[model samples]
Target: MNGVRGLLGVAVCTGLAGCAAETGYADLEAYLDAARTQATVQLEPAPTLRPVPTLSYGASALRSPFQLPVGASVADRQGAAVPGMNDPARVREPLEGFDIEQLQMVGTLSGTAGSFVLLRGGGVVYRLRIGDYLGRDQGRIVAIGDSRVDVVEVVPDGAGAWLERSRTLALKTHS
Candidate 1:
């Protein structure tokens, strides 16, 4: 074991001595310095950004797309009254404040007077009957069927006349 140890030590010392010898590349360093000095780095110029054109909206006279058209309602009022049309002087109902689209017919109720349409809106349920107003436009409840309620809304025709438009709200069943 002593002899083997001595041989291993000698082999390690020889390996280390070989590594200690200088491996010269003095010409490579001089060449790299010369090349670096001679080389010129050219960068591309930054691209010019064009100014964005300002847009002017000229649709003050036009009706907004987000809102329902008021022309039909105006024309309806301006035009002559049609038979079975609602009276504008009648007292408005609780559900009349909300838009008809926002109101949902959830169910129906029958009473001695007549059948009533149950409308749900703004987290509250309201019972509406015939002649009850329920839309942004003076939409009066004309008829109440088993699963639908018909409302007649007065709208303006483009030709300066009022017209009656029928709108229905179907019953919504929840599972």
Candidate 2:
């Protein structure tokens, strides 16, 4: 009876050990399967964030109809050098300088000379000659297209007094 009881005790202990081992094996298999599935989850690069498409209040406004405000402060985004950095007060000379302050065309230098005469402030101030040295474009009396203009040139016919004369200075435009 002692031998049988000892054998039964040993058998019971062995069965419990087997059961625990089986359970441990099953837990390990489950853990391995979970790890493999996670490894094969197919990870890809993250998508980039894009700007949203938006509309303005006046979507049809292609260009500004008004001119930009003068002396307005503006930030230069592009790294371009400022133009005309040499001269700040440089300005191109005008063609003719004559004030209409009670000014009248007296006469040019020569009678057939293509010059302009301007009487300003009750005096003959400028007798703009055709080939008078000036700035860029040479000042010349030419018929602009087909416009009829009346100009006057002074004729010094060996006379002491320069007689006030009239000549046509026309500047016509093509239609």
Candidate 3:
């Protein structure tokens, strides 16, 4: 019965395959159907990414990991807001009239917003990360370690600069 069913499936698929033209004409037809003026595909402009807001580290933000709300402190925590996220004192006034361009990204790490790789413009280059660096010389990262990163790449987090800075992690584990 299984052999007969398999043969039947193949016969049906072969009939269907022969019934339709294999050529891809849909895209060309859609292109031709549009008014000639607008039909020309203008490359969608690369989105203007709001420059990553500048960050600073200093004595005012001195909280230890043990003292933090989640037991992990701001130190070495990347993307940290200095005083607070929505403090009125930080900005002179609410920013309005500027459009926020939401970027479509090919995500690297699988999670919430914590650690994700961003592909800005379409077909743009990707900087390699941890798993990408295994057994390759181009993967040589100068600072930080696997345990130190929320994701693979090392970021300049200035909690204890020496702790995460200037340190090197070799690709191979030394015996």
Candidate 4:
């Protein structure tokens, strides 16, 4: 038994020494050293932005820049009554309740009475003529042509004044 134990101890010590003396990792160690020397990274500085300049608007006393320019005549500016103003006593027309854009010119008619235009709105067809009022904006028909109907509309100019503007309703062409 003593001899067997002594041989086992010698074998263990010899195996440990053999493992420590081995040089199988020489290439791995050289590669690591070369990589450490070659590895390098460069960083760039961040960009800086300039501040925007501030401006102050001081046109409160003058006319507003956003409001439409008032083209009222001198008489109108002098407190005279403006033409095309809605009359309170006049009866409103059925087509006046509809917008000019909503009414499509469907056809035209000419007879002994006068020239007339047929307009369709809200699933109903209405006959109109020059001087007839239509649209919610107090629009009055001024002319009826073969392909379009011209109307003069009274609209507020954003300055407590009313202005007359021309609007055209084109005839609906079948697709």
Candidate 5:
């Protein structure tokens, strides 16, 4: 009885091994080939590059930074009243020490005598009127309007003669 049972177990194992060997993988191979045919691959085109532009620098048209600004001389022209030109010997005013661009017309004041322009600069407010001097370029107040102060500045034209230029200092409005 023991020998018969052992023989039956060996026969069942042999039958399973034979069935596994006969099984085919053709269906799996056909599925993988179909997936590869249906798949698509895309590649982008390369970007075009532009050439850099060449710049030409001309020094003749540019002003010299080492020298004083254009029309900075205060020498009097051959024949002109040039109010501030002949005043070199006189005492310089307090506001004359600062540049014209640094000063700002903040507001105005009126008194019994006349109206005065209020200039603020260097952390201090200054009251000035017509004929008063301000700015390093011998700038003199000529007219005071409602919102602006007109001034005549005498500056050198890079030569021995001086030139008079009109400048306006407007009241600053804050937002």
Candidate 6:
């Protein structure tokens, strides 16, 4: 029995020695060495930052947005009263009942006597000359041209004063 055990132990030792001498990992080790030599590791460069421009706001001298518009009454702004602005005793004319915007210049009549402007308002035609009063706001005709009539009106400025406003009534051309 001791001799049989010695032979089995010697056979096991011989099989292990043969396996150690012929290892199958030689190809795998060669492939790993080749891959390591061909491999590369690179890092990208860091980015650069630019400086921002400094801007200064320049609207300190302008009017504030929270305040009202820069406008005052004619009497308050001018610091004086307009002479002969609105006469209360003046007689009203036929066209004084209508607004100046409602009157339309239809035609112009020029004769040996003087030139006249024909206006149509409220389905009625009227012949107006320079210095004639019209419109509800005491508008006096100042010029009567061939295609238009200009008037100066005295209107309240909402500050217990009157201001002269120029209005033009253009001629009505039929298509």
Residue 61 alpha-carbon offset, candidate 5, angstroms: 19
In model 4, which runs have C-alpha deviations exceeding 4 angstroms?
Answer: 1-40, 46-78
Candidate 3: which stretches are off by over 4 Å?
1-38, 60-175
TM-score of candidate 6 to 2 decimals: 0.53
State candidate 3's TM-score: 0.17
- lDDT of each residue in 133-152, candidate 5, tens digit only: 99999999999988999998
TM-score to true structure, per model: 0.50, 0.21, 0.17, 0.61, 0.54, 0.53
lDDT scores in order = 0.82, 0.42, 0.38, 0.85, 0.85, 0.83
lDDT of 2 by residue, 62-158 (tens): 5454433355322321233323222357442233343222333343343454435432233434444433322122123322112332433333323
TM-score order, best first, reads 4, 5, 6, 1, 2, 3
Clashes of 1: 7
Which of the two, 1 or 6, has more TM-score? 6
Give the clashing pairs for model 3.
none
Which TM-score value belongs to model 1? Answer: 0.50
Candidate 3 per-residue lDDT, tens place, 35-153, comes to 56475676989999888888876666775644545655565454443222233563321111111121122333444533423322233423334332211111222223333212122
Instruction: State model 2's lDDT.
Output: 0.42
Tens digits of per-residue lDDT for model 4, 19-39? 899568989999999989995
Q: Pick the candidate with the highest TM-score.
A: 4
Model 3: per-residue Cα lDDT at residue 98: 16
* Better candidate number, 4 or 6, judged by TM-score: 4
Residues 33-123, candidate 6: write the lDDT tens digits: 9989995968787788788898887998888765534784444645755544456776678999998888889999999879899998899
